[model samples]
Target: MSRSHIALVGKIAAIACIIFIVFCICFYKTIRTGFIEAQFDRASMYMQGEGNPQDFKKAREYLEQSATAGSDNAQYMLGVMYEKGQGASQDFSKAMNFYKQAANKNHAKAQYALGSMYDHARGVPEDHTEAVRWYEKSANQNNPAAQYALGYAYYNGIGTTKNIDKGLQYLQKSAENGYVKALFYIGSLYFEGKNIPQDTKKAFSYFEKAAYKGNHDAQFYLGVMYENGNGVKRDYTKAIYWYEKSSKTHSSAAFNLAKMYKNGLGVEIDYNHAFELLKRAANGNNIQAQYYLANFYDKGDNVPQDSAKAAFWYDKAAKQGDSRSAYRLGEMYIDGRGVNENFDKAFQLFQQAAQDGNVQAQLKMATIYFKGMNTPIDHNKAIEWYQKAANQNNSEALLALGNIFDQGLDVPKDQAKAVGFYQKAAEGGNVEAQLKIASFYLAGTNLPKNPAKAIEWYQKAVDQGNIQAMLALGQIYEQGIGTTEDYQKAFEIYSKGLSSHNADLQYAVGMLYAKGLGVSKDIEKARNFLKKAAQQGLVVAQREYAKLDLSNQVQDPNMQTVISYLQEAIKNGDAESMFILGNLYLNGNHVTKDTKLAKELFMQSCEKGFENACHILKTTY
Candidate 1:
């Protein structure tokens, strides 16, 4: 070829070669695009069950291949497959990975999915900030789920500073987008007054919407609103209807309904229904329901009483520091009712109860210390507990303290202190204290001799059925100490006192009968009364019984008694009996005389503060 023609041919050949290269590149691009499209189409077909045997496994495989080829939609689908285990094993880690890829590409659904994963800490450690970032991105794109999530984060301050106004703004925006979760969240916020002014009407409206959509929590809350008359008229039937609806899915609603049934508050008493509901709640790990169920078993009010079952529940509650359960365990240990009787175990449980401020336990500890029952007597500790109970206005503690001072049992003898305590107990309307105050006045021991005051206090005690007070009133009337001498009134009072089963009262009655003060002279009645009193450690009755002459051979029962009254008196704390018995020993009235036995008896009576026996022991002996 000519030089110019050869150059033109080389240029044309170069242009042709360049055109072929461009066509080949376009052809290779088309084939690669077709391959990726085919992979994604296959996944879509399997997902929709449009071709082949609607296999999620095949769909996952195709979706995985497409996702590996950088298809954002395919990646999102793959993530959903992994999340739901649709043809693949449920793998949160892999699901999150695929979702992150699509989320990075600004895929709305993927962004929401990844945000939920972070919100719930499903896959990785919960990073709320990351979740909020993705949610906001998708929410800005008008994704309804993302909008609801962003609102939740704002309302709860999950990943950002809490802003009630902003939270409600975002939630309202999501609700406007037809997001049901946003509506539910708005209801919660309104109900709790967190991100909105408390508006029960608005809350109930939103809750009704979510509840209608089968949200168990919303249904439960709506039931509560109706039951409590919040933003609605209280309707037990409607409340029960909604609670029944929620109970199918929510355990708390079942528990609340059970309580209502058990108490007959909003429903008829139905122990059987309550028990069934409680069992459901307990299975759901409702702690309060567990405690109540245990109590039912323990008391057998509605079920068979089972101590073992009670211990099971008590053990569960005790681990949670329930004081009532601890107290029950203590009682069990103390009495060996359902467990082994162990004082140490009881003490430990009682200590736990005391720490919880149980007043009865404090009193129990005081009694244990005071009586030294199964433990050593600790007076100081007893005083400490008594003081504790006294501060709580314990009636027994007040009376005990008064007695301690009056008789000097544990503390030093102080009539002033004794009067102070007795005054306290008397002010509390203690009958015994009223009578004791009356006695102090009658005897002129602590207060000045004031018969009027004595009679007034005695009348108060008499109103409380104090037999001693009646006897004292009778004496006052007989002696004209506080009132005019009325023999008939005194006789009536003494007759009433004598009818009591109390040993002291019976002895007082015997004296009145013997003296013919209350009723007509009846020697037979006097002996019978004296015999009853003698069995109760009354020294005077024993002395009177010893004086009765049983040697007479008479037809009457009084003169034909077999036992000597003197022998009965000698068994009691009678100084005269001691002298008589001593003399009997000295003179050998019924046996040989023993000088040592006589001396010993005189010394014993003398040491017992008997003046006559003391004189005999020092002089006659």
Candidate 2:
């Protein structure tokens, strides 16, 4: 062969070798891309259980392999698995790590997940600003969840400055994307009217949209609106419907539904159903439900009496900062009703409740200090607590203050201050304070004499069935002592005490009938009433009934009984009884007619200041 032909053949062979190497590189690239795609698809299929029984373990293994091969979807799935503990124990740190890997690659769901972790302090300390940064990145890519979170942050000034306009803009975008939470949040904003102008029609529209999408909070709000007729016709049936739907998961909704059943609203009262619903709400940690359940157990209302359970529920509510429950538990502790008596624990609970503005607890604190029941006597502390309760317009506290000032217990006697407190308490319908203020005004003691004011206060006390006040005010009206005589008013006031079993009231009413001072005169009625009082051992009534019996001139052999009654009256210092006895002896109506005995009785009657006897002696003798 020629030298030129051998050189050409070698160059062509080198060119052919270069072309074969290029083709092999292209073929390898195609196969590698397909392999990566296959790995991602297999992992996704396992995660979704597309053709086999669900196996989170297998899904997680496949996901780890694809995630290591740089698949963003696989990284996002692994983040979810770690977050939810589907294949292993939940670990927020691992979840955040995987989320960051996918988020760095601009995966929208992963970016949103990372934002939620920062927002909620899942693995790292919560940082609203950082959460907003990630949320903004995802929201810009039209992620509905991210848009809702960004809107909420803006509306509450959580991460960014509060801007209602921008918040509403983002929320509307998310709502348009069918995000139920955004729809519910916008409705709440309108209903609350704090950050935005309240529009109930708009609120109803948004709430209804979210409710149809099965948002429990939206359903609960719809129940409230329907029950109250807020931007809707009041319909208890609809309210119950919404409440039943939300009660599956909403504790407050369960409580409200229980109340409706208990109250027979739009349904027959079903106590059994109400009780079951209340138990469900209580187990769900509803604070109000716990408080009411405690009350039911404490009072034994429709349930077996169980003081221990009552105390348990009360303790639960007290731990949640319920002042009323704290006060009730304190009462049980101090009285040893539900638990062993512990004065120190009771005092501490009372102080806690008092500090939380419980008027009854404040009164308990004041009484403890005033009486030195468990602690050293400290009138200054007592006064401070009493004033705290009085500031809430508590009548008992006001009356207590009046007594303290009037009696000079802890300070110099201040009649003016006492009267001021008494007046306030009286105005608040306290019977004891009304009596105090009335006595002060009637006697011109520490107050200018005002008959009208005295009568007004006395009448107020009498209206509350105060026996002492009723008797005093009735006398004033009948005798024209403080005000003009109004026999009808006197009779009305006295009539209220007729059934009190009081001897004084019975005698007074009898005298009214005898003298026709109030009602029409009826001798028979007078005698009957006087007999009733006299039987109860009233000296005055005994003397009066004896006189009534003698006036009827009854020829009974039991004359000694009437005479003995007059003698007993005279012995008790009723001077008028001497004159009546003297008259009886002179007339000899129910006794022997003896002038010597009659003259002796008249002398005694005159000496005892009986003017009728003196007149008989001067004229008839």
Candidate 3:
């Protein structure tokens, strides 16, 4: 009875154990499937706002759960969210971790993300080798971004030796996959012709593709190509179109547009429109625009001359390391034109611009040091700055050096050094330097006299429309100093100076007419020439006019006017006029006889070196 009871109980116990094990297995399978499905469904719903409002917090929670459940898509999404702070605080470490997890599972986007993180040193030390490795892995899986990244790395030799062929191949793959940046890069490579054969047609094609996809850089480059006729025929119309599009975001495009408007390249020359575009570019922090706008304001070139506005734009460009703008601003400070007078500030700005190789600034610094502007005079410093400017072939600086050497101002006088500097400046087209060189040669005072050389330099100055040079050249021709006497040439040279309204040229022309040296002597022409010189207050011309007897030839009113003009000239200390009036009084032609007055006038004229008056005085008194 005990054996049968024990065997039945053992069989029942074994059946119970087997049923319990089967039930536990079924429960585990149902719960695991339900948990994974629910996590994924909820993450997708929160991420895409499907059937609910998008909630980053909820999305992050569900994505984390799904990622924990081994969902590669969820891991990649979590990486993006963490990186961009979309569904959580921005955490590069978390982003890297999630990206690594998904990347291990062969997720292309996650691999690309990991590559970018390594490339930029986000959440890790920069490792270009690691970045290239990840990019290659993702690129092999047909990831367009990764393909572009790998191509750039090859092109730039980021992690390996540069290979243009491999770089272009990878870039072509990315472009085929519709990567806009890759198309732009390929266009730039072709356009720049660096490490690749120049192919404008190919560049234009790639640029067009990216530009149509709203790539601002591609559009800007397309404008540049059109404007420069590099990748297309020179077409300002097309350039304007592309530049307008890119100018929405690119300041350089705006700057180029302003130039086009100013020069009428693509549009009618409209200074106001150009100014507007320049302002826009300057507001966008374009350094060149800032400098040019400052110049426009400073010079009142189509804008009101507002010193404050000029200073503002100059400061903007100067801060960006524009040497010309810095120098201009320094000038404004020194002259209190557009800024408060601050010698110290001006010196600082001049020094900065001088160091930046601004020739004008170097000259200004030399002048400041030499003149002791807000500082002790420093001749050595002045010499240093002047030499710097002279190295750039600045004519003014050379002229200053010549003056310093010739005058022996703070240095030993050296006429040879002065002549050398003057020659250099003359070659650089400084008219004053040419005059100085001519004087040195003509007078034989500073160097060996060479009238031929003097004539050559004088002619150079005359070519530049220097009145003094013209007069000197005329005198040389009249005196036969350098070449054979040619009265006709002398007359021509003197005639050229007539346009300058110089009194000396007028007097010379009148004398030529009176003497009949160049043309047939005509009394009317001589009188007209003398009248012109007299009107300009030439004493000799006034004296010559007074000597003419025009009481019957000229009307009484005209004679009175001439007499009054001569009297005025005498009052102004015209020695020749005094002599002529003394003769008139002595002859009693136009006034009551007064021998005392006539003698007094003769004495005054004789004292001022009137040779005729001196002779008359010696013969009579």
Q: Candidate 1 has what TM-score?
A: 0.58
lDDT for each residue of candidate 1 in 400-422, tens digit (9 for 90 to 100): 77777778766798889888878
lDDT of 2 by residue, 503-545 (tens): 7788888888888877998777777788788878898999888
Computed on alpha carbons, the lDDT of every model, listed in order, comes to 0.79, 0.88, 0.89
Provide the lDDT at 580 for model 2: 85
Candidate 1 lDDT score at position 340: 75
- lDDT per residue as tens, model 3, 1-621: 599999999999999999999889989877866876788789888888999999988988988888998888889999999999997899999999999999999999999999999999999999999999999999999999999999999988998788878988999999999999999999988888978898998999999999999999999989999999987899999999999999967889999999999999978998888889899999999999999999999999899989999999999999999999999999999899978998888888989999999999999889888998788898888988999999999999999899999988889999899989999999999999999999989989786899999999999999888999989999999989868887878889989888888888887887787778887766667778878888888777776765653434334435575787688788889987787778778889767777899999999999999899999988998
The lDDT, on a scale of 0 to 1, for candidate 2 is 0.88
How does residue 49 of candidate 2 score in lDDT?
Answer: 85
List candidate 2 stretches off by more than 4 Å. Answer: 1-41, 44-50, 463-465, 496-507, 527-550, 553-621
Instruction: List pairs with backbone clashes in candidate 3.
Output: none
Model 1 ranges with Cα > 4 A deviation: 1-56, 69-71, 83-90, 120-125, 177-180, 265-267, 318-621
User: Model 2 clash pairs?
Assistant: none
10 residues in a row with least lDDT, candidate 3 = 548-557
Show model 3 residue runs off by greater than 4 Å: 1-52, 163-165, 197-202, 268-273, 303-305, 444-448, 516-526, 547-577, 605-614
Candidate structures ordered by lDDT, highest first: 3, 2, 1
